[model samples]
Target: MKKFATITLMVFTLLIGCTPDANITSPDESTIKSQAQLIKLPALKSGLKIETNLTREKYINGYNGGSFIEQFEFQCVTGNVIINSQLNFPAGAFSGGKTITQTFNTETASLEFGPAMQFNIPVKYTLTVSGLDLTGINPETLDFVYVAQNGSITGVEYDSITMDVATGTLKVTNAKLNHFSRYGFVN
Candidate 1:
């Protein structure tokens, strides 16, 4: 399964690379933000099965902590188009904090922002998994990044989530570009 996922991501990246470098103007900030706001991400809907795992990290000074990874295997039937992607939870459950979702319409980019946390507080976050409804582009070529309130987190401001378009699984945790093959512009 791991090998298959690696191959699938490689293929997706190659597809993106093959696209001719056409002069495509990037969308404005306001436009992207507006589209992101217009779109609604339904709360993990009912009748859908969700699988989660909890991994613990033992701290030497008794600061031991853990992370909960939750994933949803479902389909988007309400929207005109359906995108398949996985959502990753870095911190854990959202018992308190804030959560926000943003999408770049023209670039077809979407992001989820979690609450801001201080030094003593641990934060929870949600990432757009495999399927993001980017209007026209195939879910396979869509890369993901989570932009959250800045403060005590390490790595890039936006967490890059990996999307295996073929298997419909999000493999990576933390913000790092998934790096995949481009499949060309959507018509």
Candidate 2:
């Protein structure tokens, strides 16, 4: 009888441990901090030019059912700024094989991911910018922004943003992207 009681108590404890907390709640839009700021890129001078780097139609197999990771580095046309970026797709994110493309617009400091489609699981975009002048700017206020094709700007919801003053690098980590669009950094 004592052994049976002990076994029942252990089962109850296991069930309670596996249960999720009822007090947990998702933050509403108002409770979430906004990371976007309205800004415009400076117009390029006649001597300056808009340069772009394109990675086209990289094929990834979906039949194998595995995570996919890709890395890209883009240099700004105007200055010494460099953006080291990565994209991570989890298993079963999509069906069948697909082609992915990325484009870096140097003049606007924006990145575009092609064949724009929504994902079942959020695609994580992590970006680190180097060689940028952060003088007089609050690094904490730096965040990623989404630029529309019509030039409308909006804030990107990011998991975290950090700055390394010594290395002159600002990193936007785990920015959840539902669909591909033009993304850039703003103060």
Candidate 3:
């Protein structure tokens, strides 16, 4: 089982990262706030990877509303991320040929966006996929609908950042972010 993976979906740099409100404690705070704000944005939806093997035809009590049936295995993990946003799974959602799920082992559930420093402040969020259980379904005719009740974002840790847009260069010093504010963002 692979412990960590980052799947890039598209090339969205400026759209995802935020524009700060110039009222922070300092430049460092302003930058970190910008990076951490990604999770608060709807764009975070593009960064999740969930797949499952369970079908709606059966239940733990029984099959087709019967008296006795079986259940399948389940798993979800967290990596070096700052924190895994708790997502609520949708209710009574089902699709004929689609599934969504995620599996994790005995890990702290910290979704490390990447080395943590650069990942915390990302130009784009890459949504990698997890395992899938395709049984008796044709790949061509596969079609189903699924939704995650909640979503998540990667964690960040950068001591300081220095950028020179004129020359297209960014320098991160101290390399470890130890503070952040978990607040709401305004549109």
Candidate 4:
């Protein structure tokens, strides 16, 4: 009986010690760190929304310069996404001599860029058009010049505009103020 009791106690101790707890987690911290790797592009948060009026402060050449209003928005979760753009004169401005208006709506979970390239962001997302409209008196022409096309990962004079689509990494380059044209609004 004494020997049997000792054996039973030993078996019970082994069973209690070997049991695995459901709440116990692994001590390896790298696994969590690897998963925590998030896209850190600062431009992603700089300003998702950009709205400004185009001014006649500068002109491309001898042609009549047209002003424009622009807006930009950005966001990223796993990857990077961006919209780079350039805008021409508003439509119907020449006829009415009034401010031409353009409205853009993005309903997707992605980002959007306006006439100003400064707000270009890198993020991973989808773009859905919620609404888009252009209205003005004379209705001047408008164009989106691709200084850096969408998904382009190189040669941006500004670091902020450059971003990694896979890793969601971002770099903010210097501001490029002189790249846009004025009188070219005709085209």
lDDT of 4: 0.29
lDDT of each: 0.33, 0.64, 0.23, 0.29
Ten residues in a row with the worst lDDT in model 2?
30-39
Ranking of predictions according to lDDT: 2, 1, 4, 3
* TM-score for each of the candidates: 0.29, 0.62, 0.18, 0.21
Q: Candidate 3 residues 1-187, lDDT tens each?
A: 2333222322243334434543434565334333332111111123455332222221211111111122222332221211122211122222122222222211211122111111122121112122222223233322111111232222333344332323322223222222121111111
Separate clash counts for every candidate: 23, 0, 22, 22
Question: Ten-residue segment with the worst summed lDDT in candidate 1?
Answer: 178-187
Residue-level lDDT of model 4, residues 114-153, one tens digit each, is: 2332212221111121112112211221211122333321
How does residue 112 of candidate 1 score in lDDT? Answer: 32
**Model 1 C-alpha lDDT per residue in residues 103-162, reported as the tens digit of each score:** 212122233322232323323333443444334433443333333333111122234435
RMSD of every candidate to native, in Å, equals 17.5, 10.2, 24.0, 21.6
The CA lDDT at 9 in model 3 is 25
Q: Cα deviation in Å at residue 22, candidate 1?
A: 26
**Stretches of candidate 3 exceeding 4 Å from the true structure:** 1-21, 27-88, 91-97, 110-187
- Which structure is stronger by TM-score: 2 or 4? 2
Name the runs in model 4 displaced over 4 angstroms: 1-65, 69-71, 79-82, 90-93, 108-187
lDDT of 4 at 27: 41
As for TM-score, the candidate ahead, 1 or 2, is 2
Candidate number achieving the greatest TM-score relative to the actual structure: 2
Better of 1 and 3 by lDDT: 1
